[model samples]
Target: MSKNGSHFKVLFRPKAETFRGGCGECQTSCQSACKTSCTVGNQSCER
Candidate 1:
């Protein structure tokens, strides 16, 4: 499979939400910034 496909699998598979949610404390601003960057199509937050 391609790199994109692998990413899709990991992103959409069950239990993925565990990794998606921010750490709440340390991730508050950082997650927001990452989400904003992603919304603009930057996609730098994929990792």
Candidate 2:
């Protein structure tokens, strides 16, 4: 994750870097990833 992306994780899903909900609840980068898969954990990033 980038410097700012990490911050978003802290503010949003601090426990996990993967998708916790939908685009609205994820970070900007995560929002994009959620459409496919999260690069961080390579998990299903969809809602």
Candidate 3:
């Protein structure tokens, strides 16, 4: 996370394939919100 905590980044990919919904709302709901929002928002993710 940045010093100010306004923005952060993390590297992760869900092990289950049932949560590939369009929006990343599932990630945050599962307590797995990606810091960069790349998994769901940008749809460019790598585990």
Number of the top candidate by lDDT?
2
Put down candidate 1 lDDT per residue, 1-47, tens digits, no spaces: 66666533433554686557544454234456765675533333333
**Local error of candidate 3 at 19, Å?**
9.1
Q: TM per model?
A: 0.19, 0.20, 0.16
Report the poorest 10 consecutive residues by lDDT, candidate 3.
24-33
Off by more than 4 A, model 3: 1-6, 18-47
| lDDT score at residue 45, model 2, on the 0-100 scale | 38
For residues 1-47, could you state the per-residue lDDT of candidate 2 as single tens digits? Answer: 66666633444545453335455644355556557765546444343
Q: Candidate 2 — which residues are off by over 4 angstroms?
A: 1-27, 38-47
Q: Ten consecutive residues with minimal summed lDDT in candidate 2?
A: 10-19
Candidate 3 residue lDDT tens string, 1-47: 66778575656767665365345433343224455444555453332
Name the regions of candidate 1 deviating beyond 4 angstroms: 1-27, 38-47
- Report the Cα RMSD per candidate: 8.7, 11.8, 14.0
